[model samples]
Target chain A: MIARLVGDAAGVMSGGVLIGPGDDAAVWQPPPHRAVVVTQDALVEGEDFRREWITPHQLGRRCLAVALSDLAAMGASAAWCTATLCAPAETVLDDVLALALGLREEAEATGCRLVGGDLSGIRGPLVVDVCAGGSVEPERALRRGAGRVGDVLAVTGTLGGAAAGLRALFGRRPPAAAPAQVDAWVETWRRPRARLIEGRRLAALGVRCAGDLSDGLLVDAERTAAASGCRAELRLEQVPLAPGLRTAFPDAWGELALGGGEDFELLLAAPRPLLERIALDWPPELAPITPVGVLREGSGVSLYADGAPLPLPRVLSRHFA
Target chain B: MIARLVGDAAGVMSGGVLIGPGDDAAVWQPPPHRAVVVTQDALVEGEDFRREWITPHQLGRRCLAVALSDLAAMGASAAWCTATLCAPAETVLDDVLALALGLREEAEATGCRLVGGDLSGIRGPLVVDVCAGGSVEPERALRRGAGRVGDVLAVTGTLGGAAAGLRALFGRRPPAAAPAQVDAWVETWRRPRARLIEGRRLAALGVRCAGDLSDGLLVDAERTAAASGCRAELRLEQVPLAPGLRTAFPDAWGELALGGGEDFELLLAAPRPLLERIALDWPPELAPITPVGVLREGSGVSLYADGAPLPLPRVLSRHFA
Candidate 1:
């Protein structure tokens, strides 16, 4: 079944894969003189998402997007991915194949191949776990702990779109959200792309510290701060909110941008000069970056609106928090 | 929680890993001259094993063994592994930590490092999926399609133990089955080892076609034959059954040995001279190999009892069959 689904890996991702999909395992002759970065992430049916909100295809694509987000944060170009999908026996074969197709399509788009995987029966919620591997030059990968005390923090693209989408899907509403805005947010939530190209740009520009905003910017910023042994001070007013977020979510925009997770955006930390240089060199094709915070010599994360202090918002991520 | 559990990737597996845990992803500088082999396997709580039959530690170890078994078949050496574990909210922290320790211990034993993973809350049964990566010499991998007509089929270690063990676990009746034998079978089911050493030996010894006997011999032999475009003929009388299997469940022994899955042994196919040479040079330290069958210019697998044709048994693997 897996072989039929995998077919042939859509060409090799960088250094050609020697064995494609069929043997007991997949073999790749990696790019010479480079380091390999690997990460894993999983999405559960009820815990991470719901069937009503996202189709099997979207969910499957989300698995690779989420997993590859880690590689993106590391400034690694994806080479291979393995996805293990466990579903109940009654699940339709077409849906399963569609999900597999979703993963395969995204992999091909990202220049990665579906190398190997296992499909099994689960008497529980549908589970899709994806492991993505990529390559980076030695010592060139971005890292959370590489953040410095005086580093300015910036983020690629925008935030709050997915959070707003979740709210719209769950019917948590205000006076009213425009139908077009709601649909856009829902699309963002359904298909979050990893910032692989932007990450490579950052690494090439010598930006050191970075992490993905899967658990919202504030939470991930705090984590990055802690890992770097520095405190984080964020200017919420400066954050680049997703398009129409401020208009559609006038009241809850702050919370959604800061606490609502799964944006798949990247949080980058570097000195002011380096960040400015990267911002200038960044092409129009890449996800744009906007400075929103700074790392400081303190212990915890602090929030501010302009010059005034503000309390941290409630975290909406369901990560055992 | 995962940070506390993973602490540090015990030690580098082969060529040292550049970046350890506690990052967006783990970075490894693999042995510069070898092709990397990767595989994934997952174990669901109820579908794969019952909690009553194995402890959390054993289950965790079982996950790695099953995953690395694929690497073993590919003649790859264990290097780095990532384990994603999803459990219900009610699960104890200690148990999860214990399971992590089991994976860590087994990885260390196999000379692999626990690089990175994700922990998530599932609303239903526990799920553990592992991705293991290893290094193999270029063009030295044992492949399923490498088999040729007149090639002899062999297996490393004994088969049927796991199948018999599964039967024992399910309490399939026996007329006064020995206590010692039952315990041994149960142990075998609980702790099946991957034949990594034997696999590397085979590759080093210039042997080619091979695959793991995760499924029973007959089914796997059929798969090998189909992949290689040849016919497999197995002599049931010359087969190796788990010790005491014939005496314990005399009536079911044939089915268990031939149809039972999860044995995690390596089923190898090579020409007669190579098999004989491998058998002669086989070390006591490695799992013993025994000749069992032969490949011919035909299709499908055929079974015989000391040259008398026999009907194929029902496949006992619960893999959507």
Candidate 2:
């Protein structure tokens, strides 16, 4: 089809492309002394986001951020990104362009360039897919597969804040909905920061096996444990939930604390012997780094509250079904 | 908000990804390679495609193939890919899943891995976007700026077949509508092959200036000339048009020959001296490569029929105003 030619030509020539759009494939070279790491993700309106909850600009930023965070988790520095948007003709072209501008700003803020993107008129929900490229030295890279049986599982920043903030946006009375907590949670939820700096710090410390908590403590932790082939038993007493979260929705608080997604915090697995060194640079007061569990030579995730196993939540996201 | 976390975490890392997603800033390591080239593109039903014209699997393949063609023209390879799809809910999940499977198959056909991607629910139209990556050795990739004066412009495949096929699909009478020509044109248009092999061949031959003909011949040639700061003059008689195309639309044959798009052929410029040595593999039968024009030391594109300047028809596509 015409598409085959379009696809083939865009990636054809192997070399001699200072910047080719087609040939066998495409090639991108980052600066010297750096290896490129790539990441990609897609977002669909209604399922992944809502127009009522996010502006186009915010959506752009979020789309870019998610892909960027993958690089951060790998301890790689973002260099360039590409975003593709599919929307209806009735959608404001100006707003869409503005969203691209916002992406440019956010990427530039992180010293990354928003190099190129694609826009198309489609009949379904608006979709944005982003690809982020970063430069990282092989030695300093981190991976989810590097955790050991004895590594200590620590998290940076507060947990459940994003989930709590979401509840507020949805008009749900989450236990963490105390006025002050809600404000804090909403801010965290709306634009959770990317822990790029911490990733570099951890990398420098020779730490590996790290991931950002996007699918809540339970799901993400399970992913890490599964990927690393280890078992993790989280201590609920040690699990950090927003203050008053338990008091408000007494029944669901534990569920939110366990399965609430979108915390966006980094769940790191490090050797217990290095705890003192890890705590040196990061203080509990500034970005509270808490250890909630330990890895073991087994499988499955177990959550304990007051020394008893709690019932697992039936659903994680409303859109999943 | 959760999407923000997903976006931030799924992208590249920079030293400043502070609590990225849920933290302050994320930390990342700088790799050994720098300078990256990126591109993105999207597809939508009705505007660029129609379900009646192709199968869902073919549609998915075409969507990615078309976007990757841009990378091919840049002389690169696919390092990774991210795709987004938006379709109606009533649509069977398996159908969409089949599309994903097709995408994966196409990706594997080319030598890249599907690192990560996203999927979500939507309402009416079906949309997809693909972002691919390629790595170039320092100072080896080609760009659109290298077309020099006296360069011979060439193409890798036949032209107008796709355009002719479009007419045929709609039951329009065209010169190429005769059984033999119509079959060739329709088949070519339905699954136009990517000239990846030819791109590599050209790259090995040291051909520098090149681009895919996503737009019609005249338009893309003009773009190459304009972007390269040179004038291009093409002899109309030397232009290639499917045989049936001449027979089908004989009155406006020249317009269709030079202006109709969606051919996906590689319209490239080669140094003058390489013409003879380069043409040995031009094979006039299948994908007959031809020299239709020469880059001049001036600006703008001029057409010649029997050594006299000829008025050219505009070949254009939908672009945001």
Candidate 3:
């Protein structure tokens, strides 16, 4: 059965993959003069998703996107990925095939290839672990430790949509919003896009420090700040909320914007001048880049609203606490 | 808790790892003129192992070893590894820490660094997935597709040990073997070594076709044969059995030798003169390399005993079927 799945998924190899699936290990001839960026992310059933909320296909695509978000955080080009799926023996074959198809589709969409992976039967929750590898100019690669005290903190795309989406997903009653509005939020929750192009653009535009907003803006910002020996001072009003988020959440929009995780957006830090220049020359095709904060000469993260200090909300961790 | 474990296991980084754990992704500077070899393997709670049979530390080491074996099969020098562990929320934190310690120990022993990984809570079972990366000269990397007709089939280290060890583990009654002998088999089952040095030696000796015998000799040899478009003919007498294996399972020794999986040894196909040369130049410090079979002008694998064709044993799949 494993061999059959691999065979069915064969012949989709991209250039540079010397040996794809069906080998002991996949070999890739990486492009010369670039360092490899590698990251591994796993999503487990119940913890990462509920079957009722996500189709197998969406789960597969989301898993790859989550893994690739790390590469994006590193400002690296998409290259190849390997995935391991641990499912129960009772899992439907078509569901597994659909999951694989989703993975292949996402890989192709991102200019990456699913070169190899493993499958196993489990007596536990379904687990999808993906290891993504990409290449970047070593000196130019974005890093969390590169943030400067005076750097302007920026984010690509609007935030808080996934969190809003999650709220809509688990709400006892349907959201008091238009059907299209509810659909948009649900879509954001189901299919968050990794800002790969925006990340590469940031690297090319001389941005040094960055990370993906998988753990929400506050936690990820704090992490970047801690890594760089600085503090993240986020201006709440400057945060670009997803359309209708303010209207949907009203009282909790601030918490959602600051703490809602799984956004998969890129958070970047660069000098004010460079950020201004980037904003001026940023391509319209990519997600809009918004300056939402600044790196200050301190440790930890601080939030401000209307020029007044605000206490950080105690948001529950989305995964294992 | 995750951060604490990562920090405690820190400082074991080897050179070439630019950005290790705690970053969004790990970055490594690969040596010039080498292709990257990557492989992923996962172990589930009940499928790959049982909690009673293996300690958390052993499980961690085994997971990394399983992944590194694929790199070894490609004759690649280990560089870095990332692992994901999904445990139930009720799992003991100490056990998780011990597992990380084991992973660090094995990675250091293999001259690779633990770069980055993910952690999540699973409601069902424990899952550990490891991804290993290494570098090898593209022209010299061993591949199963390189096998040719008339090539001698060889393997590194003893066979049937893991299978015998597994039998000892699952046996309801104590085996008739001596306690010391039982201990050895159980050890082999719990801690299989990846033949890194032997694989490199084979590659250096110009042997191209190879694969790790994780699925026992018969199955892996058949896979190699199928991949290379040749037939594998095994000489049962030539197979080097684990010490006391025949004495332990007299009637079943043949099946154990031919069908036992989890051996974690290398199966290679090379010309007779090359095999002889390899044997002559084999390093005394590495695992012993022994000739076991030959490749013919057909497909599939065949077994022989005392010059008579023997039927292949139907071995149950060790992993998910």
Return the top candidate by DockQ. Answer: 3
lDDT of 1 at B126: 91
The 0-to-1 C-alpha lDDT of every candidate, in the order given, reads: 0.87, 0.66, 0.86
- Checking candidate 1 for backbone clashes, the offending pairs are none
Q: Residue A239's C-alpha lDDT in candidate 3?
A: 97
lDDT of 2 at B187: 65
Q: lDDT per residue, candidate 2, A1-321, as tens digits? A: 212212233333322223433222234455455455666667777777677777887777777777777777777777767677777768986678667766766786766665566666765667777877776766567777678898988887767766666677777755445688777766666675666777767787878778877677787777788768898878888988766676766776667766666666778888987766888777444456788888888988887777898665653662532
For all candidates, state DockQ relative to the true structure.
0.77, 0.31, 0.80
Q: Whole-model lDDT, candidate 1?
A: 0.87
Report the first chain's TM-score for all candidates: 0.96, 0.85, 0.96
Error of 2 at A11 (Å): 25
Per-model TM-score of chain B = 0.96, 0.81, 0.96
Residues B159-246, model 3: lDDT tens digits? 8878777877786323667878877878887898888888887898899999999888999999999989999999999999999888
Taking the tens digit of each residue's C-alpha lDDT, what string does model 3 give over A71-160?
Answer: 999999989988999988899999998888888789889988887888999887789999999999999889888999999988989988
Candidate 1 vs 3: which has more DockQ: 3
Model 1 error, position B269 (Å)? 0.8
| Candidate 1 runs further than 4 Å off | A9-15, A318-321, B9-15, B318-321
